[model samples]
Target: MTSSDRSPILPASAAAPRSDSEVERLHDLILSSLDDDQADEVVSIPLAGKSTIADYLVIATGRSTRHVASMANKLAQKIKSETGQLVRIEGLATADWVLIDAGDVIVHLFRAEVRSFYNLERMWGFGDNTDSTN
Candidate 1:
């Protein structure tokens, strides 16, 4: 199905048409950066109409706490440099899980074990089978 066929999941007042290219660019940057950092089980969930939090939700697992922290830092810097938008990051102190809130995207970086335990993908309704790693 094409993007046009999908309806916005959010209410009219909460949802407004955003520049598709900008969102797509940010999504692409997040995915590519995660891959470059060797993130495991990378998954992208399209949340345009499904949620108002962000246009997209990206979840990935890092090999360890250090990896998770490193990925989070790099991703934030990358987004800032590319879009000139400062991203908000949380949970970095523990490095077990890091949440990066970019304007158009919300990224979660977690250690493999922590990721499995939380299973945000399942909570968000995207099962393990949904892999958008193209």
Candidate 2:
């Protein structure tokens, strides 16, 4: 099914109009944050009906490991300050690929080489049509 055809996997109550707007708000926040962080080849994949993990999957690349970690830290902090949600982060030590789980929006920050190797966008059916803001 197309990404837009998939229904969000949020709780029944969260399927209401209010929750939909919240999800959209979170998604927009994530995209803007990534852009502001200067992430390259940013791509957002709607996983609503396709995945139970989150409503949206955002993938982006950093110039290096430090950049990846910095982006993750900043994004996590932004999510917390904006939504009052404590985001879960992983792989910060290596900084090769950091994942931030912010309820409705999940973000993946990766080093250029690492991102190319994993190619989350292609795996998630985003193809090569990445929305690069670089």
Candidate 3:
């Protein structure tokens, strides 16, 4: 679907939008947290000029459902504690895939199989400024 045709995966926060630097800080915070959690094949896609849903799209894989869920929970906690921003989380019950909407940054944590099935990186045309921690 086109950017306009695509709907947001998570509802946008009603709070004021974050400044560019603030968004960058939040994005960095997420990357660091995922790295510390030992997420595999972590990829970051910049969506600032491409989508209005979020400034950045972060994709990461975990070994299993338990690992995905744990990373989601910990990331949510860290964002809240560090940024004082309450992020919205989804799909934690199944843990095959988890989505975290952290204002300017949207994070997806998934098992390897689930991640490959979706292939968000390719869908987003990932390249410019994208970073991977593997």
Candidate 4:
């Protein structure tokens, strides 16, 4: 879904959205690991006809430098322990933009300005619909 589609509002009166559990699972897990204050965007990029990276890319964010590193480390550990997958993390030294490469799904955690300046989603060809409320 696009960023303009509206943030997935969690109703104060509902049972919560269970519609996309797998996506949320990964999203929330990563957020928790990073202690995310809020998720700017969680999007799915369909390169169905163009590539072979499991059909999607999930973009997210963390609150700060420490948070980014903390989240990256936690996510790497989680991936290893839960899925037996070894995720390679990068840009930890900068912490302004940290990336977690999980093969089919790549996750991005960034400080707000850094996110805008680099704009990886757009550069990656998603353009304006790049999911991010920030």
Weakest lDDT window of 10 consecutive positions for candidate 4:
10-19
**What lDDT score is found at residue 17 in candidate 3?**
82
Cα distance off (Å), candidate 4, residue 4: 53
lDDT, candidate 3, 81-114, per-residue tens: 9888888999999999999988789899999999
Error of 2 at 76 (Å): 0.8
| Better candidate number, 2 or 3, judged by TM-score | 3
Whichever of 1 and 2 has more lDDT, that candidate is 1
**Candidate 2: regions farther than 4 A off:** 1-18, 126-134
Please give the distance, in angstroms, between residue 70's alpha carbon in candidate 3 and its true position after superposition: 0.5
- lDDT by residue for model 1 over 53-114, one digit each (tens)? 78888999989899999999998888879876777788999999998877678889999888
Better candidate number, 3 or 4, judged by TM-score:
3
lDDT value for candidate 1? 0.82
Weakest ten-residue segment in model 1 by summed lDDT: 9-18
lDDT scores in order: 0.82, 0.79, 0.88, 0.61
Measured against the true structure, the TM-scores of the candidates, in listed sequence, are: 0.82, 0.79, 0.86, 0.61
After superposition of all CA atoms, the RMSD between model 4 and the true structure is 14.0
User: How many clashes show up per model?
Assistant: 1, 0, 0, 0
lDDT of 4 by residue, 2-21 (tens): 89998764321122323345
Among all candidates shown, the one with the greatest TM-score: 3
Pairs clashing in candidate 4? none
Residue 11 alpha-carbon offset, candidate 1, angstroms: 21
Q: After aligning candidate 3 to the native by TM-score, how far in Å is the CA of 9 from where it should be?
A: 17
